[model samples]
Target: MIDLSSCLSESAIQISDRTSCSKNSNVSCMISPNSTPSTQNTVTCLYRTILSTRKKILITVTWSKNSLSQGLSITIGEDPSISFKVNTNPRLFRKLKGSKSLEFQGCKVEVFWDFSSARYRSVHEPEPDDGYYIFITFDSELGMFLGDKARETLQKQEKSGPRMAKFSLITRHEHFSGNSHYQTRAKFCETGAAHDILIRRSGELEGRKNSELSVSIDKKTVIRVRSLQWNFRGNQTIFLDGLLVDLMWNVHDWFCNPDSGHGVFMFRTRSGRDSRLWMEEKILHKDEKEEFSLMIFAACKNM
Candidate 1:
């Protein structure tokens, strides 16, 4: 395992403080080797927002794929202990469009989706780049909406239009497979720009005392760690969109199992004094403080 003791030292770095909220349970997307051959693509995002009724809630959206079909699920509530979820399985009915409705905390919530003409960049991506729309309405008002067809879909809806999304995408987790490089896109914070993040490692440094690890944002190289073998775990602060962000990573597995091991990375906003306590306590999850956190897991396979 990679040693993080030195990297986490207070003198070596200053971690931002974050406030804690409801605890979020781990949602696994791991594939079993004994299972039949099938494509496993999963992505999850957590949003913190207030409903039309002025009630705070956490919304989780998950997109996944298997050999036989693709599916999506939406969960809403203040916390996991009291949440409601809707699962849509397109493969079962062979339909690419559908809707569902339910009542939560006296509010009528409706979900609408149309993926008939969805387009994707690759098989590994569970989300469509275009030709899709997902709308979530609270009491006939739009609470959350996604995709490029939002305008067209809204024009066809009832007189009551959807409200602006009050929620902030606080956290996102994605799993992908690659050899030397892993790439993904994310918004560092609710109001920040969506950036393309790329993490690259070199094979030539496998047996050397130190390896090279480079991180890039929107194609611009931001930080590069040399002799990673000696420093596989650490944290650094970088400025993006005029906001300071704390970048943390642990890549010990890369050297331990070059072919199958996975690495973890996180991007979070810098907070005040309390943030230090959270770091010491290791409370790195969704919280009421609006301290947005994103974690990425990259699975590296042999090239």
Candidate 2:
């Protein structure tokens, strides 16, 4: 979790609700894993769901890929040490589809996945584009469904009737290693539109003494940092889909140590309560309403 209170309050700006994005906002892309020439790619999606016991639990699905193989891991609420993982490319486990039974906080949970025919937009992406399904069940009820083959998966289940899952995506975390230019897609709010998010840093390429940072949404630049060396850590506010998005970045490592330093960027929406309060370590596990946030960790090799 990020302590965005200081960042958002220090550089908050006032913007009218009438502000609109680019006319090409209609265009959208798949929320795939980050891309890099040579590095491990990993993406984790967190969801808040309710069990039959009325207990709220957080489920995290992490997809990862490296030079060796591809992997998938599922963990319950905040603890990564205890998890159920699947290696998609194991010599002993040649099968591409399977099911697992696990217990969490005394509640029984079942996870099902199939990736034999999974498709991908790019070879470097960890998650698939289509032709797959990942489902979670609690007390014989569907708790969550992912992928494009939902209808087909439900038909094959043993349950006669399936009920909808009361779940929402709370946050997403991604890691990538490459140049300063980073691209991904996101939906600021649950009911809002998904826009293209691009972050770029350039100074050496332009023959300038100081580097600059720019953020673009839907092909339109929304935030720019003219002197990145002086202001390597900062925040800005932007309006999207009638919501206020607080964006913060810390690229201190990129300037201080260019060899093996990573940058952290965060984009969170302001709703009923401050994101800082809800993101506290204690509050994250407690029962709470839905909130969306995106966190990016970029490792710049040749900035």
Candidate 3:
């Protein structure tokens, strides 16, 4: 089993040795006494994709929204030293559609995006469910498609040279504020089903003396944390679709500082059988290629 003590930061959370949940679990305690409030609202998705150069690179698509600003950003490669980036705001473009051509790592790259007719499940979600397409072409040899309008984009562009690019989702990071009940979806593997994830916190309910936290997947309660004030930070292991998933949460801010307090939850699964081993220093290893991570940062102003 992976040690949650070395994985979590002591400044943010303390390690708990208490055994809660199931037998295959490691629970760490959380208590950030001076955690400040967070007002960020954004969603970022990182993908591990290969270009025509046969080299691996990472692509980051980010959407950010605040009271006065809302925009989209796409960044290629690991660093800004040699990358292709596009930043656009809906209010400024009105159409929310455009294309840009650039060179990345000595290869010709083209980016096309159309969100004018996109549909969103919620205002908090920056990614659209349908009626949108974001395409990235490398040397006109391969293309990466995001969204559901690949066919529409192909027919309109009439470019038959670039095939589809093979990519793997690395991690999804989201920041949301407002309520205690948060819901999202995650797919542990490429061939696995996308499971509905719900995180809820109950405060001094009818039968409960202190707040409690529960994590559910596909409507099934998988992990529960009791006496949340004392165990605000912890980790658990659960099996899903025959694979082991590491679950971690830190809600110290939610209880200690509610005005702008933020809580964090993470669901991670590895492609290797030794998923029991974790990165002591970093989230990824130099050779460990296939890992899926979902991180949620939720804040509540009222509870």
Which model scores highest in lDDT?
2
Report the error of model 1 at residue 82, Å: 8.5
Residues 4-122 of candidate 3 have per-residue lDDT tens digits of 33555424322222332234234332324443323337888888776555677677888777666666777777665544344434455465778878677787778888877777766
Candidate 1 vs candidate 2: the TM-score winner is 2
**Regions of candidate 1 where Cα sits further than 4 Å from its true position:** 1-7, 14-40, 66-68, 78-93, 151-165, 189-192, 204-210, 257-261, 271-290
Per-candidate alpha-carbon RMSD to the true structure: 9.0, 4.8, 7.5
Pairs of colliding residues, candidate 1: 17-275, 18-275, 21-287, 142-162, 142-163
As a whole number from 0 to 100, the lDDT of residue 123 in candidate 3 is: 60
Q: Which is the better candidate, 2 or 3, if ranked by lDDT?
A: 2
Each model's lDDT comes to 0.64, 0.71, 0.67
Q: Pick the candidate with the highest TM-score.
A: 2
Among all windows of 10 consecutive residues in model 1, the one with the lowest summed lDDT is 19-28
Please, what is the TM-score per model?
0.73, 0.82, 0.76
lDDT of 1 by residue, 107-200 (tens): 7878788887778766656777788898887787667877878767777765765565576676777766645566677776556677777677
- Count of backbone clashes for each model? 5, 0, 2
True-structure lDDT of candidate 3 = 0.67
Error of 3 at 293 (Å): 0.2
